[model samples]
Target: MKKLISLLLNRLTLVLLLILAQFIVLVWLINFFSNSWQNIQIALMVLSLLMVLYILTRNDNPEFKLAWVIPILAFPIFGGFFYLFFRAQNLNMKTRNHLYNVVKERQYILSQNIDYGLKGNYKKIETFLESDFWPSYKHTNSIFLPSGESKLKVLLEDLKKAEKFIFMEYFIITKSKMWDEILEVLIEKQKQGVEIRIMYDDFGSATKLPLGYYKKLRALGFKVISFNTLKVHLNFAMNYRDHRKIVVIDNKIGYTGGINIGDEYTNSTKTFGHWHDAAIKIEGDAVWTLTILFLENWRFSTKEKISYEDYYLDYKVEKPNGLYVPFGDLPLDKNHMAKDIYLSLISEANESIYISTPYLILDNEMVTALKLAAKSGIDVNIVIPGIPDKKMVYMVSESYVPELLLAGVKVYKYKPGFIHSKIIVVDRKVAMIGTSNLDYRSLYLHFENNIFLYDASSIIDMVDYFIETIADSVLITPQEMKKRNIFYRVIQTILRAFSPLL
Candidate 1:
């Protein structure tokens, strides 16, 4: 009973309940209006028909479109107007105009500076450049930090060393030991007169952080923006979030990965047995790209004018060999660059593709790609958490397992605890590590960033780390997947069907 009360008192639970109640009220109003007047009913039906027609002709993803179309057609009275009120994709683009504009303009300049020197025709690199306008650079050095604990230590060290300026952007930030430690460094740096700017997603940190947390940080003389500050609104615009985690120090060093600013990330106070995650510390010219990514987002959040050249520094290692491409994906556009990038990596892998993600709610294209890769004799291996942080999400991830296991794609459940690492190593020749997960949220809805390493030394570390992780994980056969009860399987299927919306 105490456990039940605690769950009910949870901030996340309260917020979800409020949102559900609001949606119910909205549906009731729509029904009431339509039933009260024949003309209103006729108008709503026509509106529903028009919306269905428009959705069919949209150039969006097929699955995403279908998810909306079904409800609108089924309940013509409420669905059409509710979708009208809650259609967040268009709302997101409309509301975040400055953010989108800044991203595009900065990306244009960054693309022009690409120095892909003799990195002959790897279409995947070209895919990022031509499509996303994110450039590839040589003379960049990378160090792969295999766990969040290692990453936190190095991050603090780097933060303390910031001489000129520091920039940090994260999806979530809670008042925990991890944030306290980082805040201590920032406060010291603030006293030293170093420029510090921090941004955290308002929706992502809504439950994790106390209200007006940004105001508190600002009071300490550090510039901060609560990205897309959540307000009471029926619009679906709040669904889009800035999920990118970045830390740029003096344009010389940059860090990004699955880790967020919370104790669970570093296992200081474990929510699930142990929180295992990966992050990358990239030093040199590639750091410039990360710097641009942060600055552009910061500029949008504050409407603060920045002389882009003032932030540029000649920070690059001397005569480095391999290629490094730091890129990002914004969900406002029709292009699903992150998903395409993942598919490209999977398709190009000759020997093996090793993946580790906390979530595995995949769309059809991704599912087909993984299955096809396994059938084509590619060693496709995946690792998910053994102990889940969210049981429903874990179940949705499990729903994809049996089909993959049947197709010869090896699946492993990490035995230690929940693994939050978002990593993919392809044949030891290329690798991608960053904020992207194998789920729809990372690939479709959220703003995310990642680095592509081609023949870079860091790929070896990523590959080696995967080798170590899988060794500690439990491999499951088709028979093992079948052990799930029928009732449990039904719930997993139902959750998965609405995954796109989730």
Candidate 2:
């Protein structure tokens, strides 16, 4: 009870309340004038028409365009204004161009000289290479981490060996057991003259960490940034959050996946019962890609020029593993990079597809691709949480279950607790593990990161782990979904309609 009250009184709470108050006032004023003034009503109607026409021509998901069109027609007076208010970028034009320039300069990483005999997967890999400007590496060693606890153990051990610098970026980080242990190691390493840089999404950490948290971290002799700080304003820029989880040490080793720096991730607080998550470590040649991913974002946030050559190191791993491609999905980019990779994987898989994700709010393209894969007699399985972290998102997931089940796609609910991992293993030969969920937000809205790996021995271990998790899950039959009453189904349908916005 005390904690609840304290949270309610936090600065984030106060700022949110202020934003809500402003929104309500704006809506009230618009509604009042639209009813009273003939000129105002006509102007708003014209605005609504223009908005609908503009939305129709956008090169985005058709479903997303339909989602917006519904509201614009229903509340013609306020809907267009609301759309403009939310879609407008808060950042100035100069800043936007600078962000673009930084990424543009890193385009060289998209091409690599070293090649491999990836016989039939050239088209699948080329999407990341040409579209997103991410290279596929040939000589990197990777190890699969099955759980957050496992990642933490390996991460702490690796952090202790940081010789030059450590770059850490995540969507969420709170003051907790997991963070404390990592911070202790980081502090000791900083004292030893190892450079430390930390970046996290401000909206994700706003309530958990105090205001100006980065300033506090800087005081402790670390370079830190609270990316996209939460402001009491209406802007779509806040929706484009940095949802990537990365830990790059000395440009020699890197770690990434669904895990975050929170006690719940490590199952210490059990915020969502037994929290299930995963992360993987890449050592040798490919770690450089992870390092570059961090440095690009770090430069964008900090506005500091980085000597790319200074961080370059030719790492050598004994008994090196298979091909690895670490890439990030930029919300600002025209192409839906991660979603395309997922589609290629589903379309190319000849045997089976195993997936575990916390959210399953997919776009039409993904849904169709999955259904086709299942209909082709391929073993298709998706494991979601029995206990969800977000009920609305969970219901949105449940809304898709009926159609998916009918199409022969098997869906399972993990019985133990909320499974936060985002992983896809195809044909026991290729896998993708990372922070991008099987949801609209991860696919189209948030900045996300994931690794595309092929022919890695760890792929088998990941598949085995997914199979073990399926054993602990309950399969959702078609008849089982029929048990939901009318009211429950209606609510789910409503959530699904606006899911793209979420």
Candidate 3:
């Protein structure tokens, strides 16, 4: 009874209830007006038809369009009203202007100091990223971590070396052994007068961290903010989340990948069998790019105008020679940069393509690219989780297996447990590792970050790790997929149809 009461009083639950009540009221009013007024009924029907037309004309993913169109066609009144309420994708104007000013003011100054000597296809990739405002760097050293436990050890050691400020942004931050150990170090660093700031997604950490956790951090003199804080009302803005995991120490070292702040990442707790993940540690001029990514988010969340000079490291550090292009994707931007990068990598692969992701929901464009690559006799392999964290999403992911298999794309399921790593390696010469998952949300709806390496030693390391993981994974056969029941296939089709919303 106490647990039930606690759940009912939870902030997320309360907010959801409030939103549900509002939706119910809206539906009730629509029905009442339709019965009482012929004009109102005709007007609502016309609005729904217009909404369907508008959705079809908008340049959006077909799956996303279909998800809305089917519902609107079924329930004209309420569906049109809901779509009208939630359709706008713009950030608040003030926040958008501030972000643009921050980037515009620093773009040239930051780009002038680094030179990425690119050749052949690497040059082409660099040029594309530059055109999209993601600059390539030359002086950064990249270290590909194969597991979360390995990253945590290196992260702690790097944290101990911080002299000035520490910035961390993650999708989820839970109060667990992993966070407790990191927090202890952060608290000690605070005593030494080192500045610290953290940003975490409210929706991601809703069930893990207690309410007012950010307030407690602020009281402790740590600058902390929740990304898109949840409210007791309907909010379409809440759908776009900050899903990037970034840590920058003193503007010299940075880390980003699939790992979040939880014991599961470390494989200390067996929530999903053995938890497998990956991260990349970067040092040198490229770290500054990550610092900017964090600051842009901080400025937006806090509404603070920041001088770039305050956190920018003026001195250059000697690092290994390679091209490291760290980039970000914003829902406000029309360019789907991350997905485009993945598609290009697949299309450009000459020898082999290896990928690891938690989810495998691909749109037609990506599927076509991969299929073409495989049909051309390039080795194409993908690894996903054997144990899933979300069962419905897992079912949806499985729905794509048969078509990909028929197209000659090889798919593997890690036999040990869930693999949360987001990595792609092509031809053993180019690789990308970071927070963007291979799904509609990461590609279309979330703010994400990734690093692409050209001719970097990390590419070889990533390839080696992929081979090792494949040894432990079980390759899926067409026969195995065909064994699924007809009822299950029907469910999968229904789930896949609406996967964009999932």
Candidate 4:
């Protein structure tokens, strides 16, 4: 009977099963409601309707607002319940105020020493920031990698040198040789009373770590906490897992980007075939921003907010050599710092705009900006993973490729492996590298960071690295894209429609 059921089950059959389960759940809940329950349900339904209307009225993203409204109109009771579970995704006034203050305070400090002298021929970045983000920061040194292999080597070398503290946080951390080596170092550091702390998303590390892994780390004298631990009731929050990969050592050196703690990130996994990732290793005042970000998340998880004065140390002047500006993105913040920075770079580019990301699902504003940049004769290019780990996401990204092609933007697929790097280079003078992917989730839902490099030399090196990687890439032409099957075409349409939520 089980074999027969398995044989009969297909994609359509599975979807039907899910629909049936949802209907059953709806019916059961409605039937179980008492008179008072019904009244309370009516009140909740009214409140939900008002909220939906308010969201639709305020939000410019029609697709995102629609994602919330469709189910509610279809089945008010069930949809309202589901929406209630996921309501935290909507920004509240409190968080908005917090973001405003955080940005203000941060800008105040960063602007004190930031040098705007690095602005070369690119006028867009300078104008946008000098007007909006209040661009500040003294100096930043950039080391751009067109390859993940090289970045990992630098990261490991940095890790080996930690003396006082090591705080490593990533979306995913597997128990492989790559991590084992780092873990061994961290363990040794802990043994030497170096204060080792690690925070990994429970969902990302679910299959990699055992249930009692936190306790195991605690036993090893390493402070460890799993962010947003998986629970059936709090499943909505689980979807908004910490997608950031940050490493701060003694608040002096830091690293952040699309790289995770696994062999796949290092391109040793046969599953993803070849992986292309980018990460930056910074040694300067910029490390402090990453330090604060880690500490904030750590405080939220551990319930002990350390004083800012303790963490914010005055950086003694060494030289005007390296000025680092590190900024972060939060789900609650509407500023969209990562996207804003990327857009600024794209808009300001005169020579070129080069981007490498695993996912590419642009909102209307982002799409418009890229289109305008390409139309203005800027050499816009993007590199995506040839082999995608998520089929739906890949199809969705592929659907958007043609539009950019029409706008004269060249797209490349990393032939060797999956390209998981979230990096953008503008005019060979400015480089932005970090954990923020060019997708709605990274833009609006996840905690992310992007380090801005103001040094002209570093930006030039980054541009050179990107050019080198492009040599290993397979350029996608318009004619070749037409060869995809109808099934894939249909899937792409459906996935793209739902990309905002994905």
Best by lDDT: 3
Worst 10 residues of 4 by lDDT: 231-240
Arrange candidates by lDDT, highest first: which order?
3, 2, 1, 4
- Give candidate 3's error at residue 421 in angstroms: 0.6
Residue-wise lDDT of candidate 3 within 44-153, one digit each (tens)?
78999999999999999898899889988999965786677666554668867876776666566566643555444667777788776677777778888999899999
Instruction: Identify the leading candidate in terms of TM-score.
Output: 2
Winner on TM-score between 1 and 4 is 1
- Model 4, 212-244: lDDT tens digits are 678988898988998867643321443457888
Give the alpha carbon lDDT tens digit for every residue of 357-445 in model 2: 99999888899999999999999999999899899899999999999999999999999999999999999998889888998888988
Which stretches of model 4 miss by more than 4 angstroms? 1-27, 31-51, 74-77, 87-135, 145-148, 311-323
Q: Least accurate stretch of 10 residues (summed lDDT) in model 2?
A: 113-122
lDDT of each: 0.84, 0.86, 0.87, 0.73
lDDT tens digits by residue: candidate 1, 1-502? 9668756765556666877888888668767886577887778889999889988898877877888898899899767876777674544455567767887779777877765453544665565555567777777888899987899999999999999999999999988999999999999999999999999998788778766778899999999998877654566445668999999999999999999999999888879888889999988888988998888888877778887778888876765747778888887776777677788889888999999999999889899999999999999999999899889899999999989988889999999999998988888878888999988778888888988777788888888899999999999878887888999989987787767776
Clashes by residue pair, model 3: none
The reply for model 2, stretches above 4 Å from the true place, is: 27-36, 109-123, 126-131, 234-237
- Alpha carbon lDDT of residue 131, candidate 2? 51
- Return the TM-score for each candidate structure: 0.92, 0.96, 0.95, 0.83
Rank the models by TM-score, top first.
2, 3, 1, 4
